[model samples]
Target: MIALEKQLKDELKRFEAKEESIETIFIGGGTPSTVDPILYQKIFKLLKPYIKTNAEITTEANPNSATKAWLQGMYDLGVNRVSFGVQSFDQDKLKALNRAHSPKQAKIAVLTAKEIGFKNLSLDLIYNYQGDTKALLKSDIEQAFELPINHISAYELTIESGTKFASTPKVRQEDDELAFFVAKEITKHGFKHYEISNFGSYESEHNKGYWKLKDYIGVGAGAVGFLKDTRYYPSTDIDAYIKNPLKIKEESLTTDELLTERLFLGLRSNIGVDKNILNKAMKKRADFLVEKEKLFKDNNLYKNTNYFISDELVLYILG
Candidate 1:
């Protein structure tokens, strides 16, 4: 672990020297909270000189690993934000998803984080499970609000091609509908539906940078980085990352692809997308949507009727 910390520190210095600006740093993926707090402190100390004072430093933890002491250690080490992987509050659903923590444990984790003085806390919830009903989803949302968290990220269960669920039949359409329903319910609770799958009582400065297409540097296995107009990703292999942390494969996004990404990411916010970016056909479609009350138009931008339905609106517009 100490050796890995040293490698990470070295890589962060290299990136900072190579890139001029790095607005946010996200230390997530594969249970970062499992590492010792001292290692985190060491890493932070090394990178402190390069990062801005208001930089959003985020670390991810599984509910099972989010102990009170561990959370306190992370907070003491300069981690300002924490995101937990609490997929659901239903014990049956948790079991089906092969989660490690129970519903009670998940609640305890959130309470512990609050008790440990974490102001910017976020919880992850999964929706659209097979056999999941609206009542169950509502219960989940109610439980999320019960926590002192300001942010909630609700994700629709998707079956990827290589996953075990890919070969097995599961609820896809039902989950999509349930995701929408959950979004609406949460928005009514005073949380701002900021992104397609992210909700918060207040805006997330860290994520706002990403949605605004600002530069960020990610360090870890399979981590991605974006600076200026170029993007790159590290090898997914853990062994490769440990050996050669600087070996990043670069990829260039085309002009049209960049414009499409900007439009797509922008529409996810309540801020809406610029009307000038849309073609004549898209503008016509937007007019029809606005007339149907499915969309709201303010000046040169078009937004979803409910900011929570940004995903559905994006699909409708892009389709």
Candidate 2:
């Protein structure tokens, strides 16, 4: 924890961030609720000057570990938002996904946060597992809406390398329709489908910042930071990072790479691509899609009509 504080302090120094410049801060990428909130105090104290007064500060928590005391401590520290990893409300599905918490525990964790005065709460739901069905996903969505949360992120099950499912890849179902089903069910309840995987009555500022290609400072092991066209990375190994927090890597993105990123990110969300950023060939392809009703041009920006076909459309434009 001390090492992380030092590293964050160093990273901020390098960036020369101005006071009240950070509009949002998200503490995620791992199970953060397991850590004592006291450990977070120094980091918050150090970042207080740079964080805006109305900053949408968020921390990702596991339902099993985010106890009432933990939520209260973080709330006292000015963390006004919480994103819980609920995954699913079905016991069998939770077991299948190897989640540590039960449905009851997930409910308690979220309700506890709400009772503690958190106005902004979000939870994640995973769909398209081997046994996932419309009935099952519908129930999951229904249970989620029962909670006092404004946001939900429904993700399709994908086998990533190094995970147990990578060996038995069949655990992930290959169902395209379920994505639409889940999206429709979520938006039916009034939350906007602001991104491919996320829906919310109150949209996430952190998510929007990334899609709009805004620069952000990332800290801790394996965290990535962006400044203009360059990306910064510290050591991935926790021990190595703590030992020498200064060791870092840098990558400068090419113009073509940046363009590809913009196309994918912009199409995946309501943050449509700027027309001026497209070359003549890409513009021609985009216009063709607009003619086909696959995309709609909002004056100077071109937005996707269906996020599900976003990848294919971006690839078409790129070609």
Candidate 3:
């Protein structure tokens, strides 16, 4: 935490805060609750002036570790949002997924955060894993809505290389119908389907900003930072990063590469791709999809009606 704080102190300077206040700060991907909240205090204190007053401060937590005291400690630090990694409510499924927390613990963690005055609460629910059925997912969603959470991220299971599941990739069931079923089930509860995998009454600015290609600081090992068309990779080696935090590898994207990226990210979320950003050939292809009802045009923006085919749509447009 100390090394991270020192690195962040320098990294955050890259953003010209005079032009715009930081809108969102996301502490995610890892188990944030494992560390003491007291460790985060200095970082928050440092960020106060550069961040907007209404900035959505979110921290991702594991339900098994986020106790009431931990939740309270984070709440006291101006952390207004908690996104628990509660993959499912089904005990059998939880065990199958190798989750640490039980359904009871997940519920308790969320309630504890709410009790600590967290207004924006979210949890992740995974689908399309082997043995997932409509009934099982329905029960999971029902259990989730019973909590005081305002948001849910429903992610499809994908077999990334090098994980245990990678050897048996079939564990990630390729069921398109189940994907549609999950979306319908979640949105029927009155939440907006803002992204391919996210549904919520209160949308996450941190998430939207990423899709819109906004610049964000990335301080931790292997974390990525974006500024305009270039990406910065801090040393993934933790010891090297702490020893010399200034050393970073940079990659600058070409116009085509940047456009390709924008299309993929935009089409996967509520942020539609701007027609002006597309070249003449790309614009014509997008217009053709719009006419074919595969995509819908809202004024100057071309949006994918079905997010499942976002990759195909982008590839076609790029061609």
How does each model score on TM-score?
0.86, 0.98, 0.96
Predicted candidate 3 versus true structure: per-residue lDDT over 199-299, tens digit per residue? 99999999999999999888788788899989989898889988887788989999988888999999998899999999899899999998999999888
Which segments of model 1 are wrong by more than 4 Å?
Answer: 1-22, 169-175, 275-300, 306-319
| Location of the lowest summed lDDT over 10 successive residues in candidate 1 | 14-23
Return the candidate ranking by TM-score, descending: 2, 3, 1
Which scores greater on TM-score, model 1 or model 2?
Answer: 2
Give the alpha carbon lDDT tens digit for every residue of 198-259 in model 1.
89986677777777677766666787777666787877798877777767788888876666
Each candidate: how many clashes? 1, 0, 0
Off by over 4 Å in 3: none
The TM-score that candidate 2 achieves is 0.98
lDDT of 2 at 82: 99
lDDT over C-alpha atoms for residue 165 of model 1: 76
Q: Best candidate, TM-score-wise? A: 2
RMSD of candidate 1 to true structure, Å: 3.2
User: Which 10-residue window of candidate 3 scores lowest in summed lDDT?
Assistant: 11-20
Clashing pairs in model 3, backbone N/Cα/C closer than 3 A: none
